[model samples]
Target: MFILTLSETECRKMLADNRLARLACAKGKQPYVVPIYYAYAGDHLYAFSLPGRKIEWMRENPLVSVLVEECGHGEEWRSVIVDGRFEELPDRIGHKRERDRAWSLLSRHADWWEPGDLKPVTPPLSKYEPEVFFRISIDRLSGRAAKAA
Candidate 1:
């Protein structure tokens, strides 16, 4: 098998073609990673999530990373990594345009709402808070692919 580096275009294409990814954040050297769904548009990746540990950590430290991967049979696979800055899309003034864009982008996918908006249904809870919107402004994107010779 052989491994090759992917160009910026290829990396962006991989990110665009995939929706599920792993987002990594850190708080005082303790790194946390979780699977997330995102929409890639322009130079940013948009997502939805509730206020939680990851949100808190990202708020404290805007630097973050996202990983997207594709796997094929027989040792054929590829992965893309994005190092970016996380920024929340508040509903308040001065961010309406961005918020709208994020919504538009996220709405493009049918499974977009599954990641962060899911609520427990087994016990039947009455109160479940809505998810907030955020985006990662990509600073760098890299990718690698392996194919059997």
Candidate 2:
């Protein structure tokens, strides 16, 4: 596979198109990776989740690695990897706002918000009161783009 550096515009495009990312966090020697839905605003990545296993793990360890990638037909692909620290936002109102923002992003890409039964059954913030929202402050960001030869 060939690799080329992605420009800022390219990086933003990739971020805008891909709504799902894999977040990798480690505590001590063990590492954990989980798929998350994220939204990019300015220079930060935001994601929301209810208090769960991942939230507990992140509370114990804040450092993380996130990967967002897109692969199309003919092997054309792009990916961005971010290494940084994650801060969990505890404000309930703020968490709700960010959760709405993330859902908006998903609605744009997928049919999750479509006008039908296929749409999300319950209100986005109903079950998750003590929601966990995080902002990833990117310490290092790198990307690659490649096309099939």
Candidate 3:
């Protein structure tokens, strides 16, 4: 098999094409990862979630990473890793424009609100749990593609 590094343009193209990624964040020595749907725009990834563990951890430490991957037939695969900082868009006057932008970008997908909108049945959350809109400002992008030799 052969593994090749993807260029900046290739990496960005992949990000733009994909909708789901594994979002990772760290607090002190502990790291957390979860699957999230996002919209790629300019140099940031816009996503939505409830006030949960990831939201809390990211607020405490803005540094985060995302992994997007695609697998094809016969051992062909590609993956990208993004290192970024998270910035929340609250429901306020100052962030209205950005919040709208996030909505507009994400709304293009048919099921954009799935999983994020889902709530746990047993461990019920508060009815007042606020929806969170945030962006991961991309700092770096690295990717690799593997193909059968």
Per-model TM-score, in order, reads 0.92, 0.72, 0.96
Report the CA-based lDDT of candidate 3 relative to the real structure.
0.95
Residue 82 displacement in candidate 2 (angstroms): 1.0
Q: Best candidate per lDDT, number?
A: 3
Better of 2 and 3 by lDDT: 3
lDDT string, candidate 3, 9-126, tens digits = 9999999999999999999999999999999999999999988889999999999999999998899999999999999999999999999999999999998976677767677764
Report the lDDT tens digits of candidate 1 across residue range 122-146. 8755677656899999999999999
- lDDT for every model? 0.91, 0.72, 0.95
Q: Residue 74: error of model 1 in Å? A: 1.0
Decreasing lDDT order of the candidates? 3, 1, 2
Candidate with best TM-score:
3
Give the Cα error of residue 51 in candidate 2, in Å: 1.8
Given candidate 3, what's the lDDT at residue 43? 98
TM-score of 3: 0.96
Model 2, residue pairs in steric clash: none
| Residue 131 lDDT in candidate 2 | 47
Per-residue lDDT tens digits for candidate 2, residues 44-103, read 777767666567777898888999988867878889998888877666675666556655
* Clashing pairs in model 3, backbone N/Cα/C closer than 3 A: none
